[model samples]
Target: MDLYITEKPSVAEALAKYFNSTGANFKKEKNCYKDTKKNIFITWAVGHLLYQNPPEAYNPEWKNWKLDTLPMIPTIFKKTPYAAKKEQYKAVISLIKDATTIINVGDPDREGQVLIDELLPANKKVKRLLLNALDETSIRKALDDIKDNKAFSGLYAAGDCRSEIDWLLGMNLTRFFSLKAREGGYTTVMSVGRVKAPTLALIVNREAEITGFKTQKYYNIFAHLKINGVTVKASFVGDRITAKSEAEKIVTASKSSELKVTDVFKKSNKQEIKELYSLDTLQIDADKYFGLSADDTLKTIQKLYESKYLSYPRSDCKYLPTSQFTDSPNLIIAFNEAQLLDVKIPLPNLRPPVFNDAKVSAHHAIVPTGKIPDLSTLSKNEKDLYLLVLKKYASIFFPVYEYESHKVILTNGKYDFTFTTKITVNSGWTALYKNMPVSDDAEHEQDNEVEISTAVKAGTAYRVETFELKDAETKPPRRYTEGSLIKAMNNIKGDTKESNNILSKIKGIGTPATRATIIKELIAGEQLSKKGKTLIPTEKGKNLIAILPEIITKADYTANMEILLDQLEAGKIPKQKIITEVTDFLNTIIKQKDSLKIVNKDFPCPTCRKGFLMIKYYKDPDTNTVIEYAKCNNAECNQITPAKNNKPKIITCPVCKKGFMISKKNSKTKNIFYACSCYPDCKTVLSEDDFNKKRG
Candidate 1:
């Protein structure tokens, strides 16, 4: 019997169903999907069955993160099944023992290449089934073209190398820096990562650039010309006027002049729907349209995928399999039956170019699985995300956007002015996105163009009416919003000199699968704080980057490391070498003499500026419970409050402008209320309901 191991339950069911259609009846058993006559027993791993052994698993002494035991590098990493998933692993082993051959049906991605492959029993005949899609037809096609599992050894090594690299750096460097922080009287546990370090560095560096930007004043002369009663606004060109006097002179001189149209250029262009959403693009759009965090978007998409409304959400690839492209008509039918669209747009008799089998490197782009979901049962987040995908899916059936990009140059006796605008020929696919916060298309900004009469001749003259000189200063670089930050992460091209001329070789810091987690982790660590849509680094975040070596923090350097991983995947480098090099790098950093110093004093109170808060875990003698609290050091202000995730739950007071809000439990009601830290000086208190309702 051939035992098939899949990464998840859905794939197992799909594979079983496909075989069932081919004259075999598959029954849902306790552990494996059983088909006795067809000699197939399919089992699955719930994500990763085994995890990398912790520091203590290697040496018990290394369990505690200490400066003395720094750089505890294990030559050979060990693995153990998770305590919770041990039973599933046992059931898998039980199935494997009775099978003659095993079919590895992992998703055809880097991580998937190794996850299911790692679970197969040794010395058993193993074959690989690259099930790119869960559709029955795709599954049958994959089964017929099954190859030896050894063919994916390189891909497996790449994924394994990436995991071990993260573990090595995360364990040693996080411990090294965190221990150093602890020695310096800080409670910060620095969660470092190979990819995360560079991501944080990018945010920190961008903030610095904004801080150092110098504002420069400039003047522009705006010419308002009334041609055939249609007023068109144009800005002065050629040399920029830095002096207000020069700009005013031009405005005064051109006020009474007749503006002659020097040149008129118009070119018709067509824009089709954008390529399907890769996880990166989808995350970006979700953030832009709905202010949804990349992490939240991924979670919502995952829910949609599991609910069968969508395909794989973690896929990096955005191209669909050719078979699935041909299968799109059925999906259209399903979506229509499910009433997926707000308006019933006409489906054109055309095939989209997004379908190419060769382009589907991993799982195909996230798409509808032709399953009708109960729209009423979906959460707001789920519905919002589904709509986002639905729009893109439906867009391919619409006509291309046709527009005439027009530019007109106007000239007086001494100065020349120009204005550019687009005249819409057809609304096409863009009609779906009207009145939305659009992605940064160069022509998308309203300020980029002005409307003009399409009938105006090249040599037509008009009176220069109501011209003005506007003075403006160059603004500093804007802080990165979540959407723009994700775009930056995905677009890995750096300046040639900055990236050591390897600009074209590397793609990004983190994969689509991990970038959201990296950003969320940074925010959770209090290294980053979100103010509105923009991200600002906290003092702790700034301090950590200050002491870190250039190699760890620079994105290009990490991107180079990503290039190495790609090489590892292509069999250009050995996986052990990658691990060994990282271990050695950790050793050098741990051996450094300088100590990390943060500007913050010893637990300065987050609420009260006058006092410091000391965190302590207390044991209840009667209840035998261990609970943590932050107690103020000032004897007069002896305030004891429950610890907020090992830190004080300090919020700025809404009533009192000078003090922060501290949680106080009422002795009578046993309910929490927020009180001003200033207390008697500013006796402002609010109920817990108000506390939860207030925004920071």
Candidate 2:
């Protein structure tokens, strides 16, 4: 019997349909679909049925976070079936045992490769089915060109190393920090991981920069002059003046009311068309235009791919393979027929920028699969995102934007002033976005572009009508939005000696598929937050960074690890060597754990006056909702109270007269409200002011 295993049931179903083309039907069983005529047994795993064992699984003593049991490094790593997916794992194992040959039909990525590779029996003949798209044509093509399973051994190694390394670091550090924080009277679990730590550090560092920023008041002198019956606004050569006295001096010196144009410069420039959309760039643009978060953009695009309207969405490559260029005309024809494109301009000739095989990695750039779907069937967000992908596809075929820039320098009695203007000679690709709102950054970039008098010439003198002083203050750096954070993560370069060589060759801090997940985890762990598009670090997050060593918080550390993973994938280094190095590093850090200090801030427990309060997180098993709270230190008197932002106040509930009111914040919406302390019983909620007034 020939066995076919897929990453998901949907994919298995899709593949089963093709094999059941004959009159001989497919019998749906408890765990698999059997095609009797073709002698094929098709089954699927719900992502990964197996995962790395936690520290507790290695040894019972490692279950509790203790200083003496720090750095629980298992001499031999092990895998266990996810409790929720054990049935699926057993089904796959049973099918593998019965089959003469097994086919691995997983996603075309390192994680996907490892997910199936770990489950296979050494004696069975294994083959790989590399399906790029779920469409019938792509799937059939891949079926006809299956390769030996051994071909993906390197990818399996890379994925295995990544999982083990992450498990080792996450389990050890999370335990170490959580235990250490107990000394400071902070009882909440201080979770830390290889990727998550550096990612959180990025937010915390940005928050520091924002908080430390000092606003400085400054002034700029502007001159309104008339030249050839036209009014033009010019600014002093040295723009900002720190002192009002200096600005006043410029105004006083300009009392002559005459200015001479010392020099005029004009030049034409063109902005090259942007490259095609990689996952990161696509997420950034979608966030900029449609206000979609990085996760939302990724989810929507992934849906589009599964729906066969687009190719694989998790690609990091921005350039397409040269062979794909040959198929571009057909794709363009399909796009046009779908009425997806709004551009009326003629498509330009195929250029090298759009197709370069050298730059193509595991996957090519994301583009339309030339498979059009019913427009009405897609949701508003899906339609918007699909259109975004289509526009970027169309953009490459449009002419570059061309404009002429003009600059003029004028001289007053003792100072020189300057003016500039830009004339659009051609809209080019920019015409596609003529209807959209100008981006905030684009508007700022063009702030200096003003209307200029055509008659103005070099060495010509004109009368200055008046001098106006504009007051401005320095603004701090803007907080990271999900989009900008994605960009930052992608651009983070290693500057530390330990990571410089490794990280310099790595493209970004995280892969295209994992960056959104990293951000999502940070938010889930209460280490980071989202206010609209802006990402903010929570008090817990700030505290975690405050206590964490520089090595863990630095991007270089994670970047170096990623480079090693990449090297593992490329077969440059053995997995054991990397594991050994990581183990030694873990041991070194574990020894120094004693030297780390945590500031104790425990307060006497209000609920149980005999005990002090320590931070803790509680999850409602029914809802799977996690809430951080303060708990009494005494084991016998286990009284709990909400923590930090949601900590209860002295106010009495108006609705539930017997209970006190506590502030409760919605995790997703970030809205604050007051609820009765006796939740699930006296479920009373009030406005912040109302609660405060009631307390008063």
Where is the poorest 10-residue window by lDDT in model 1? 439-448
RMSD (Cα, Å) of model 1: 6.8
Q: Candidate 1, TM-score vs. the true structure?
A: 0.83
Q: Over all chains combined, what TM-score does candidate 2 have?
A: 0.78
Report the CA-based lDDT of candidate 2 relative to the real structure: 0.79
- What are the clashing pairs of model 2? none
lDDT of 2 by residue, 1-696 (tens): 999999888678878787666354777888999988778899999888998987888899988778898777788889999999999999899889899999998887888898998999789899999865454565666778999999889989998888999888888888888777766566467788877877888888899999999999999888888765666788888756899999998898788678888888988899866578999999888888888888899999999988978777888878776656666677777677777656653544756387775666656688877678788999988988888787777777777888777798989758888888666777777767766644554325743457543535788888888888889888888888888888888877667655765654555577788899989988987778799878999877888888777787887777677778888888999998899988888888788776886643336655446776666667879799987666666778766555655343355666767776666788898877777777879998887577556644
Q: Please, what are the lDDT tens digits per residue for candidate 1 over residues 130-228?
A: 988776667778878999988888888888877788788889888887767654435768878877777787789899999999989999778887655
Cα lDDT of all candidates, in order?
A: 0.78, 0.79
lDDT of 2 at 622: 77
Model 2: residues with Cα > 4 Å off, grouped in runs: 1-46, 82-95, 102-109, 127-148, 225-232, 255-260, 337-342, 371-378, 412-414, 442-444, 451-466, 496-501, 562-574, 592-595, 600-696
